[model samples]
Target chain A: MKTNKTSRAAQAFEKSLAARPTGRYVLRLFVAGATARSRQAVLRVRQLCEAELKDNCTLEVIDIYQQPNLARDNQIVATPTLIKEFPRPVRRFIGNLANITGLFVELDLGAKGKIAV
Target chain B: MKNNRPKSTSPVVHLPKCPTGIQGLDEITGGGLPRGRPTLVCGGAGCGKTLLAVEFLVRGAVQFGEPGVFMAFEETEAELKANVASLGFDLAGLVQRKKIVIDYVHIERSEVQESGEYDLEGLFVRLNHAIDSTGAKRVVLDTLEALFASLPNEAILRAELRRLFRWLKDKGVTAVITAERGRDQLTRHGLEEYVSDCVILLEHRVYDQIATRNLRVVKYRGALHGTNEFPFLIGDEGISVLPITSLGLNHKISSERIATGIPRLDAMLGGRGFFRGSSILLTGTPGTGKTIVAANFAQAACRRGERTLFFSFEESPNQIIRNMHSIGLRLEPLVKRGLLRFHAARPSLYGLEMHLATMFKEIVTFQPDVVVMDPITSLMDAGTASECRAMVTRLVDYLKAGQVTSLFTSLTQGGHALQQSEASMSSLMDAWLLLQDYEGNGERNRVLYVLKARGMAHSNQIREFLISDHGIDVVDAYIGASGVLTGSARAAQAALEKAAVLASQQEAAQLKREVERKRAALERQISGLRSDYETEAMELRRIAEQVGTRTFVLGTERAASGILRQADAKVAVGTRGKPGHGRRN
Candidate 1:
């Protein structure tokens, strides 16, 4: 499980590196430890950054258990909280990132073609 | 911790407690909130729930030397600091000193979207980090119910909250969690369900347009606590809860006596005065000089270099000073000297509890040796009769505990009701002086007498209470066949008595003069009779001489006076001898 987490973290880092600098969306996902829900939220946000907003998003996932100070500084109350840091306006999404359309609409991302589940 | 246990038949395992350092709060909670556990403090909006939580943390940090972490869900750090600063809490200073750490948890529902299962591990992490950074032994989550409004999933929130409480318990830091009062439950979000070791409910109630804040401990899992609603107020320092019946009757008493300002009045009261550290009740009818008596007592106390505090419910401080000045009581000088303080407020200014709290505050701040409440009956109008009695009882108990002498003036309507109204309060007093009005002989007079004086031989004679420019003077009221006479009637009676004495004195003098004249006349008459008797004796002597000469001439004149005298003597001797012989025969 530890190796899998490291590999996923590396993939997300590569994806953010490949994203273009211009009009890039800066995002941070706050999750608790290595729970399945945290893993799902991490995977979902990374997939959205890669599939929908390709080469235009930088996503960083932080485990509150590992970096509790950051959680305190950001006032993170719920786990799996996704924060849009660099967009013109800061926004936050709590809970697992399950509904893609709803997330896209709330993030002010223009309505795009529906992606297959 | 073991010393805090009650000596009862229950098991001896005592619950450890963390002192809140709030006045009168620790006594009510038996020590304080259950230690190393989350206690729920629920109240309605603007009911001082947040302030209580903040005070708990601040007191813990500052007074108990226990570093605290305040995690505010409703207010930010700046806002909380500004809010508590009004109560004189130096939040910024505490924060800078590393004694307290404030973590403002901001969760905006409109700016967030919930998609799936979530836990409050983030909160746990933040709380843990804040506590660890400051090495805090105390934590406060002010109004954690804000999460219920921010989080959409109740099932997940409840589970996370439960786990969060369990985690906090395991962490072993005493925590205070504030929640909004619910309609049918202890908290709006049922936060009490999880943080159930102790629950404190704060209520703000209005009676007769006056508001009173009350606090009650609803439950304590393994401890004994006060279940009655105690009145609490947010004073300049912080929140102070007043436990009505907590003060026991085991105060050290003083045997020293203090004089009433009126010398004669003091004479009426055991010749010395009221016992030190005793509760004195002064009851009177309207315009019967109750305030004057109270002022006298206060002045006497001040003169003795004792700090005196006078609470006037009907008059302002300036008015009392001016009025007392008219009666020759110069309280201003004593006040300037700081030995006397006058606190005046209308009875209707606030609720009875508020007045009591203010009085307690004043007594504490001044630490006066003597406290005088001028016309305490006016305060009865602010609350029920029973409430007034309870207030008096608590006040007396408090004053006694501090070894303070208290004098309470009660205004009676008049007539027989005078004793009836003060019957309830008089029992708590060590000395009770009653001032009454006597209306007769076309005048009204004030009379004073000691009705009761415990542990002292007090006078039962009613004295005519006189208030003049020189102050109070108690004189004996005239008790004659016409009943008790006062005012002009007493003076008239005195005058009549004087006149009767004078008339009797004059008649005795006149009879003495007549006896002197009669004796003088009798002496003159005796002198006249003596002169007449002397003249008659002289004439008799001359006649005898002539008779002797004539008898001598007639008996050949002479040989005469002697011969005539011899013959006469012989005749007289013969007559006497014949009379004696006849008597003998």
Candidate 2:
């Protein structure tokens, strides 16, 4: 449950260092329904995460339409959803996965899905 | 609309009912088309669909004694009746006479829906009742677009429509069905697909920013129709198609060439005359005397003690007569004598078919020996290409069959006078005449040319015709210093050419004067040298005796005349040029 909060916080960071092996903590988000409003939200989230995480963050995005059943196990409800999978406990966020400022305050930073501070 | 599949036993053959003979319309439709056959009249906005329907019913009663039924899907009966009051249709009178039955159906199709196997029995019952009551031989469906949204499932409605058409055919009546046209195709939502016995499309297109109503007949199941698009007009007489193509029909041969009250025009047609009962086309640019020519035709017809019907699409009869009077057509007496009938209407008043029908009926009723429509292009708004063509062809054929002489005046585009009128309409007439504004001498002059006259020995000469107080009369072929004179351009051209020729001649004269002046100076110098040489010789002889020397050559003498005698003068002045060179040595 703490990992969920950390992943949420991680989403606020516009860029992640998760791609790097040394500081790698890869976070992936999957969304359904690439509608105008949902796409707008994704754009905001992507911007905020990149701006906050700086050089040590990595984020990968995949649409649910590309793989549907994966979303069911993830318990996705609303469209424009975001999932923080990989590196410990997975976390999911429903609604507009936007609000970079509030999201960065709750996401994790390590393999244990906790803030590195 | 070819209802019969190969297996079907007998296709119901419905004889096209003639819409009430409206002057120009009955001529185009070849006797009003099959009664209740649902001839679709379609066009874009303001293409005169409603007016055409009204005209057909009104004229049916007035002219043909055939009562009519008009079902309105677009407007109220009162509204349509009011709209066409100015067209001289007298719809209210017809209704009162029980000659016309009008049912204005205002139900919105969008709100009405038939979920199951609902039949249009109510509409048919109402229509049949109206038809039976009025004894209408002609039926008009104002528009089909509004009915579509009112009835759900177009496929079913289409089937119902098919049944309705079959019913009309079984009843043996002629029908004029109006359809709203989509922006892209001929009819909205392909209503044409279902009703296809004869499709007349009215087109209002902006070419060079001028909106013209053109009627085209896309398909005619059983009859030969005019294939070219014809122009139509709407006015007090309703829609009038202008194409008077005289196809293969026996025309009354009148050897008498009634002079176009204008001597200029009559002379242009021929010194003897135009074929007595032939159709004439007066075509020219605006203000180039097209109306004047039409008036000439009218006056000539009236003068021969023959009745003439003049249909003016753009101007009122009074205005036409007034204006023509100024240019020189005296028609007030003709109107009083009932020898001339002048009808004016806007081209947007009715669809092309209706306009033509009204014209034909009017012509037939008047029993006019001659007919004229001024600026026929104004009527092009009534229908699309195919309808106008069929209607015009029918009109000309009808006229020819009746042996009634006809003439149409077409307003031509600038510089393309002959082309706009003669080329397109020549095939439809026995004689095609062109009125043009030719530029010469910095002025525009009206020149007339006869392009083609079938079955007549017509003059190939372009004649000079002028309009004065009396009427139109041909003077002679204007043989000026330049080409021809017609209106401002041809007159100006002649002036310019004459000026150019004069300028060239002046230049040559100036050159000749300069050469003569130079030659005179040379002659004066030679004469002066001869006198100077004599004086010098006298002095030289006296000097040589004093000097006692052998004769010296003029090269060393260095006298004033020596320059004159330097070459040719040396031989000539040596005492009659003694031995030429030997004497000189």
Candidate 3:
């Protein structure tokens, strides 16, 4: 009876681990309008996600002028703000997202120290 | 093109105002801040900008019955409540009662990083929610400059800050936005040029190592305001800004007289005393009984059932009470009865502005009929001479406007600059009493003289100010050959005058007796001569009678013999005798 209980507990732990998504990213970008900075931020974030995150990431770009409620709900005090929503410990960065190297380092998906758990 | 013309000729409309409910502030502001408009209150760090803003909101809620919302960007709600608790503002209670709300908008710079352009719609939503929750009529953004330091986007923050102010105006809420004072502009980001309606600048400056907080109305779009810098104080109560220039010389003048507690001194002031609302100055040298005189005035005011506030800079309250005990002024009883209040502090404890502000606050709270500042000269120790003068002038003006009798004691150093500084505020005084130490005949005496009393006839003579175990005594000025005499010299001179008068009286009596003796002698001689003449006449008459009788008898015997010859001889001798007698007579 004890062997049977231990085997079932191990099987449940393996099943929970298999259900977790691997190397997947979820993001939300907030912008004021289609200004130069906002456009550049959208383009840079899209390029980063396609190149680095590929099909594993889902990105939602919100224009504050059109969707001010969503922006306000998230406390978006500045425009072109990006929020990492998935893969535990959500993070936020406020910029045009043009500095890809600094962005990768801040996103924690660099060559080393990528989020493992 | 159509020329726009008015349909009717109506009077010009003016901007509405909301009263701040602050002492002297509303007067200087002509009413208060422009209603339904944004007012920028910018000041340096710890210069009372936040206090002023919070006070604006709290007063609106409490005094005006208008609800308010305080969206703090710097301090938390609990911190603000604790901070204003000392000011007697129960913000938590107001919040619970739904009369006001304090929403602290905390922005953690480390938790969030700026990526691109965004607006402060979150702050607006939260502020709007608070205002709606209480239907607030007033709103305060305390230390809005904290956002510039917290947030990374300056251009967007500036734009949003402008929009926020405009939005508050659109909401028809009288808003107060506090900002940190900038180097050259009224605000760090030049918020003054954007605010436009009104701009108030507060400064905490250290002059001569003493810090004083001053407030000035930099710009009021369409209102007339006092442009001078006014001193403010943040004490147990909230901010109290003294609008020194708001009060003109239009205060009501009282003709009622109040005693100086010294009967003789009152007599010197034309059988009355200081005017009920007059400003009296007592200037003296060190240890010349200036404090004693001020204490006497306070005692007199309290004895008359009027409240009195005594501000002692050189001595503590206990020291004053104990020292005044020797002079028989029982201030402790009046203090117990709540008629007399003693606020003693060192002159160096605060700047002159702070001292004035504290005095003003106490006066308002105590509502005293009389205020006595013992040794106002100590105020010069806290500030420059000119600054002290300005502070004193404002104090006098405030007291005069309230029709509260005020007494100021000053110490003169007996030199040119000291004299100039001593009489610095004499011109503002309605009555000036000068005390001096008269050193004569190897002793020093306290002498008091009324230097000036406007609109009333006061004694110009200096009196001997005697403070004994009984009370203050003002003896009559003794004028001798050596100018004015006081102390033992006066008594000695008075005794000499009495002796001289007595000696002159004795001399006049002696001369009168000699003249009476000479007159009696001349009268006795005349009487003796008259008596002798009378006796001689009587004897002559008697001899003539006897001779006549004898002659008659002899004539009768001889006339018979030779009648004819005798008759002829007798007629001739009688005629000759009669002619000689008539000629001799």
What's the candidate order when arranged by decreasing TM-score? Answer: 1, 3, 2
Candidate 1 has a DockQ of 0.55
Summing lDDT over every window of 10 consecutive residues in candidate 1 chain B, give the lowest-scoring window: B555-564
User: What's the TM-score of each model vs. the native?
Assistant: 0.84, 0.42, 0.74
Which of candidates 1 and 3 is the stronger one according to TM-score? 1
lDDT of 2 by residue, B62-143 (tens): 8778888888777787897787887776788878888888876654322222212333444565576678777788888777
Superposed Cα deviation of residue B348, candidate 1 (Å): 4.7
Q: What would the per-residue lDDT of candidate 3 be over residues B1-585, giving only the tens digit for each residue?
A: 111335467644566889998777887888899899988888888899888988888889889999998878789889999988988988889888999888776656775665444567557766777787689999998878778888877788778888988899899999888888788878888864476588888999998789888889988887878888888888776888776566687889889999998889999999898899999999888898888888988998998999999998988899999999988888899999999999988889988867887787789999999999988888888988888888888888889989999999988876456457666689889898888888889999988888889988988787888878998887876886688888888888889989999999999999998888888898899899999999999999999999998767655645543354455655665454444434433
Best by TM-score: 1
DockQ of 3: 0.23
Better of 2 and 3 by DockQ: 3
Would you give the TM-score of chain B in model 1?
A: 0.86
lDDT measured at residue B228 in model 2 versus the true structure, 0 to 100: 69
Task: List ranges where model 2 is wrong by over 4 Å.
Answer: A1-117, B1-257, B263-270, B381-390, B416-421, B477-585
DockQ (Cα-based) for each candidate? 0.55, 0.00, 0.23
C-alpha lDDT score of every prediction, in listed order: 0.86, 0.66, 0.81
